[model samples]
Target chain A: MAADNDTISGYTAAFEGFEASLNGGARSPLHARRREAIAHLQEHGLPTARFEAWRHTNPAPLANGCFPPVVTAGKLSAEAIQPFVVSGIDGPLLVFADGQFVPGLSRVGDLPDGVQVHSLSAADSETAAIITANLAALALGAEHGFAALNTAFVRDGAVVTIHAGCTMDVPVQILHVSTGQAGLTTPRTLVVAAAGSRASVVETFASTTAGAGVLTSSVAEIVVGAGAVVEHARIHLHGADSLHAGTMHVTEEQDARFTAHTFCLAGRILREDVHTVLRGEHIESTLNGLSLPLGDDHVDNYTTIEHVAPDCSSHELYKGVVGGRAHNVFRGKIHVHQAAQRTDAYQSNQNLLMSDDAEINSKPQLEIYADDVKCSHGSTTGQLDPDALFYLQARGVGLQQARGVLTRAFAGELVDRLQHEGLRTHVERLVSARLDAVLADQGGAR
Target chain B: MLKITNLHATVDGTEILKGINLEVAPGEIHAIMGPNGSGKSTLAQVLAGHDAFTVTEGSVRYENEDLLDMAPEDRARKGVFLAFQYPVEIPGVNSAYFLRTGLNEVRKARGEEEIDAYDFLALIREKMALVEMDESFLKRSVNEGFSGGEKKRHEVLQMAVLEPRLAILDETDSGLDIDALRVVAHGVNQLHTPQNSAIVVTHYQRLLEYIVPDFVHVLMDGRIVRSGGKELALQLEDKGYDWIREETAAAAAATQPAGA
Candidate 1:
């Protein structure tokens, strides 16, 4: 126990060093905010195993060894990262390589009046002031050490603002790519849609390194103004040896609507935290996610939706399939405040374990303080039925193919939630590729 | 050709098939009729190598090979097929893909090259016609949401494609209607050949009218108590099973006097 305490103290000291390095830079409003966040993290230190949220996800990986901090001095070429772009979205594109803005790779066409799409460092005075007012306002706090650390070293991310009553037909794509081995990078994004504005954004993270230890900590803050509509999708397909931690914070104004989808497929250890706050009446929010992990990979998704106003609605569904020795954890919580009467919230998490050695831990919780709220939560975990397997075998299908078919069907339910045809096809291909790899590995082992 | 000699099987510590003996030669169709719990289905399951049934004492020889020693899948690879009474519903696995995989697996096990996608599609189109099944059925999940008659027809389609050396229809006609029974029987009859055999397990003789078995056997208490030609099925169907039960009891008593 004494040794454990010393190890934790060492990690805190290293984080203090990281904070000092960031504050030593020039002073801008963004820089000032980063300095303040580092000071806050220094006072709080890293979370321990005793923390309920960090119980299943141990932070020893981050604290085990030294990882050199990476910074990008100039923009990356668009031709070098063209293959990583998602096709068919016409809106302005923001590209980031190694957690720094890559202006050369971006293609921003003519935008509507009062619509701004720029890097955090390149933002003008007015835009920077708006960002300062809301940056890191919804950080996960000391309970989540990665979120705090991300805030401490946060350099350049994307910031978009749509003025009142403006509607954009195109979707803004934020592409974040990481290169090299054992490099740690944090990409931060802040989105604000003014009253009666509407927009859609797609955020994708990919790794160019084959077998590198890349740790990416990302945070995206969304504010939907009154009567505004926002649809956001976040996709994570990092390298198998990478560590990914992401948090999404959404705030809804009166009569505003927000929908977010998080898809996780490839990564070594991934922890996703989604927190949504309904601050106005008649607001709507939807949170959906699908995760497929194979071999010894592990994924954990924690989502919370808070209803702080009356007549608000929120729905969340997360599904996962685990094979080989993989493990998955899903924790979803729906909270209704004391005065949040007439709040309707539904939360569910389901998992399918393909192998006996695989494990899935799911906990769906509802904490309601209002008497008139309707909130419910449920979770289930199971494997393919033997009877179904035999039925397929008797039909002449080999055992392995039969199992793959069933597992795909189990995860297909979540893929069907994607309304966009192209996105759905892309996600389906990713899920199928993951399944094929799992099958190939098992075949090799046998 | 298939032969079963003194086959005794147990399920869950209780004996279900005690000293059962029968023989089915190629080009012949045999119908096994019995009352409920008479072990007719057990024989089909045993031949298919279902793991739940323990063959405590028996020998199942298929084409001179020891069938009892093979795995269920191995039995399939060796040309033995069982049409389940309750076909399992496997969602997410398309019917066409399932059949193609099964066909290619058996082909590969026999040291033959696999069929390409174009050839597979052609083969499936030819086989689907035997049961009057639509091409659209190939896109749906295997047996998922399929009606009882459709599932039975699907089974026949599989049997038609695999062309097993010995096929066991385990109460395949139980839930099917008259028309479905005729279609299923027609599909089975079309596959009959001097190199192939079939065993039809049914509780009613109605299915026999279409299949027209070469030999009919009555199974009771886990053993065959009577054997005759196709006419016996009609007799049993008209008179019911009570008379056969009484005759079997009297015959047993006569064979061993009062004190033996």
Candidate 2:
């Protein structure tokens, strides 16, 4: 217990170190919220195996090990980050290295009249007001240790604001590159889509090193106003040995629609928490996720969809391909409140186990308090269909290649949902390449 | 192009095919007719190198190569094709893409030039018309949500695209309507050449009217009881299979030793 306290204090000390460097914005409301967030972490400390959310994934690395905040941004050339960029996207490209904004490598020169893409640290007055008002509003600091640490440690992150009646022709790409620094980097992103607006945002987390033990605790908050449509994709392309914990909070208003696509492709230990709330009537929320974990990697996804109003609908589909001796966990909860009548919710979690030792733990829950609501949840974990495999092979495809093709099709189901051609193609390519590596590591021809 | 001698196979230790012998030559279509549970499907599966069946005692020669020793894909690459009775529905794999990959693999194995997507689309369009398949079927997942007749037609569509030397049709006419049957048979007949051969396995003689096999063999109790020209199929259709079963019993009784 004492060692745990010491590690918690280590983070507190890092917070203090960051607070001391703050000169002008220290007195701002966002900074004050940061102070309160650290105080909460100091009081509660980190969660353990006893915690419900932390039961499947062991947080000892973040609970016991001390990863001081990345004080300075790591220097990376434009060429180094080129591979992570999605080609053919005409929208602004916001780049971050080691959790700090890299303006030299970013392309923010865009005039979408009402669209704003800039760093949180360099936000304009109006943007700052929106950020301070809505940043921690959805994702509160008392949720967990990672959320608190993200609020306390983030100095620079991406802030996208879409005005009312506006539309973004191309998706805004936000790429966070880790320099493999042996520290904790907390990247914060806030997206506010005003009423009658529409846009797509793609956030990718990647590492520059093949095997670097860096911890990234990211927090993102999205506000979809009335009648707005927002599409968001979170992609993880971390190193083989990197660790990631991300939380995204989205609130949809009346008649608004929000779709979230999460692709966890790499990383040794990955945890993703997607919390969404339908705050008004006739709102729709869709959550889609795909995780391909190879080797001994561990990936856990916890999603919660809360229906706070009547006539709201939510759909969730999460798929995983577990290879090697990897482990995957998916726990989804769809809660319909008493006042929310006529609420419709559906959740499904499907996994394909590639190796004998690979394992998956899936739990889909529906807590419906309203009597007039309709809800259904199902979870299935299975191997590649032998009939499908033989059918492909009988067509002259090699055994190993047949397995690869089937596995790709399993993951490609979600990738095809991406409406953007360039992003969809890019994700397809990434998923294919990673799938090949995973199948190859399985020692082909099994 | 294909020869099987004294072939015996089993599924889960239960013998299905026992002492089967047959020979197929180029440009010839031999229809194997049998009642249910007579191992008609089992023989087709075994020839395609399906691992579920254990070939207890058999020697199958395809183009003078030991067909049993090769993997299912290897046999396919060596110009052997089996049109399954029940075509599998593979979701998320587009029909066009699946056909292209399969064709490329066959071409690569034959040391022929691989066809690009554009040319393959053109070739597939021509073949699709042979089976009356709509253009939308090409974009759908392979055989997924296809009607029973449509599945049969897709099998023939694959036969047209793959262009194998030896094609095995395992009950391809089952569950198909008259129009669909004619279309499927037309596709198979068009793909048939003097250099290629086909084995049309069916339980009914209705398909033989369209396919017009060079020879027809009646399979019963896992062995070829009788073999004759296409007229033999008509005889079975008229007299039913019980007559042949009775004849087989009579022949066995005559071969038995006198009272001992």
Q: Give the whole-model CA lDDT for all candidates, comma-separated.
A: 0.82, 0.90
Best by lDDT, which number?
Answer: 2
Give the clashing pairs for model 2: none
Model 2 CA deviation exceeding 4 Å by range: A139-143, A443-446
Per-residue lDDT for A244-356 in model 2, tens only?
Answer: 88999999999999999999999999999989989999998999999999888899999999999999999999999988888899999999999899998999999998888
TM-score of 1: 0.83
Error of 2 at A364 (Å): 0.5
After the best TM-score superposition of candidate 1, give how far the Cα of residue B206 lies from its true spot, in angstroms. 2.8
lDDT of 2 by residue, B1-260 (tens): 88899999999999999999999988888999999989899999898888899999979998898999999999999899999998898889999989999999999999999999899989999999988999899899999899999999999999999999999999999999999999999999998899999999999999999999999999998999999999999999999999999999999999999995
TM-score, A chain, model 1: 0.89
Q: What is the TM-score of each candidate against the true structure?
A: 0.83, 0.98
